[model samples]
Target: MTIPPIVRQVVVGASASDAYAAWTRQIGTWWPLQRHSVYKQDTSVAFVDDQIVETSSTGETATWGTVISAEPPSSLTFTWHPGHGAERASTVTVDFVPIGADRTLVRLTHTGWEVFAEPLDAREEYRGGWVGVLANLRAALPPSSGGAEDVWLILEAAPGLAATGSVFAHPLFAEHLVFIDKLKADGVLVAAGPLPDEPGHGQTIIRVPASEAAGYIDAAHDDPAVAGDLLVLRVRPWHVMVPGV
Candidate 1:
C-alpha cells in the first residue's frame, strides 16, 4: 500500500526568478495563515536561515520545516511539519519551470505520507489544502502576460488619514471602490489587493501600453480617496526582467 506523491501545478505571470522569489522570499506576504496555520491567530510565515518559521503577533515562533536544498529560479526542497515534530516531517519539493519569457509553470510535490498514522486520510486532506495554498500563490504572483515585452503599471496606495482600523467604514472608501471599478471597466486593471504585511496599504496592477501609461496616472489621481487625502497613490512602471536583470 504505497501512497502516490501529491503533485500540484500553477502557472504564474512572472519570470522564473520572479516566481521563485515570490514563492520563497515573499511567502509571508501571500500565505493564508488565517486558514492554514499551526496557531489560530493571524501569524506570519517566512523562510528564515534555511528554515520555514511562523511567528505570531505575540512574538512566539514555530518551526514549520527546514530547507533541504534550494536552487534559485529552479527548484526548492524542504521538510514539512508544522504542528508536528521532526519525526513526522514529510518532504515537499517545488520546481519552477519557465514556460515563456515571463511565464513559469510551478509544480509542487509532497511526499512521505507513510509517516502518518493514517496515510490515506492525511493525503486526502492535504490534497484539498494544497489547492488553496496554490491558489494563494497564483494570486500573489502577477497575472499571466504575453512575455517580457508586455508593460504593466503598479499603483501603490498607502494610507494617509484613513490609516486607522476603521478604514473600511470611512466615508471615502466607497468612492475608492468606484475608482477601482472604473479601471476594471476600462479593461486596464490586472489585479489588486491589500498588502498582507503592511496594514492600510494596497497595490493595483494595470496593463497599459508604455505610451499611454502617463495618462492612466492622471486618471488614477481622480480616485476620491486620493483626492481627499484619505489615501496616497503613486504609479510605477513595471516589466518582467530576465533572471540576470
Candidate 2:
C-alpha cells in the first residue's frame, strides 16, 4: 500500500520571482552540506543536463531527479531519486503562491512513495529532511520590500542564569535590549521576545541577506549579556512557515 504525500509550506518574505530564482539557481548556498546530500561531501547541487544533480569534490556525480515541469516564479515538478536510479523515482511538486506583494507561500508535495523499496522509511526520512531543506531555501533568498525577511537565530542564557530563573534580573538585561534595538534599527531584526513557558530562553527572527547572516550572528553574539557570560548564545538558520499579522 502507498502512503500519503509529504507536504510542507513556508511563507518566504520575498517576491515570487526572487524565491523561485533562489530555489532553482542558488540552491547550494544554504543547503545543509553536512546533513542532506547523496555523498558525505557534496561540492554543489545544480540543474544540469535535464536533471537535478549533486556533484562531489572528487568529481563523482549523483542524479537527484529528472525535471518534468519547470514553470518559473510559480511551480516546479520533478522526479526525485536521490539514492536510487530513475527506475525508483518519486515525484515532487513545489508551488509558489504570492500572498502579498512581498510575501510568497512556498508549498512542497512529495508523492509517489510506492516507487521506493521501503516506502515508509523513505517517507519518514523525507518528512524531516524537507524541513531543513526549506529552511535553507528561506535563508538563501533575499528579503522582500519594506525591509523584512525570515531567518532563524539561536539564544542561550548563561548556564546558571537559566537554572536560577534570574536572567531577566541580570544587570546586563537592559543593555541587551539596547543591543537588540540597534539591530532592529539597522533592519536586521524583525521580532524578538522571551519564551514565557521556557524560563530564560528567548528567540529572535531577523531579516538579512544570506551572505551577511554570519556577520549578523557574530554581532548578536557580541550582545553585552552574551559577551559578559550573563547569557550564552546559540544560532541556527530557520524558515518561517507563517508570518504574524
Would you list the C-alpha lDDT of every candidate in the order shown?
0.76, 0.70
**Which digits, one per residue and each the tens of the lDDT, describe model 2 over residues 93-209?**
888866434666677878898887788788778877987888777666543445333344433343222234478887788878998899789877777888888867787767665
By TM-score, the best candidate is 1
Tens-digit lDDT track for model 1 on 135-236? 888788755433334457677877753445455568897888888898899887888888989877789988865434434655776677766556766455
Q: Against the hidden true structure, what lDDT does model 2 obtain?
A: 0.70
What is the lDDT for 91 in model 2? Answer: 98
Off by over 4 Å in 2: 142-245
Residue 239 miss distance in model 2 (angstroms): 23
How many clashes does each candidate structure show, in the order listed?
A: 0, 1
For model 1 the TM-score comes to 0.59
lDDT for model 1: 0.76
Per-residue error for 157 in candidate 2, Å, reads: 38
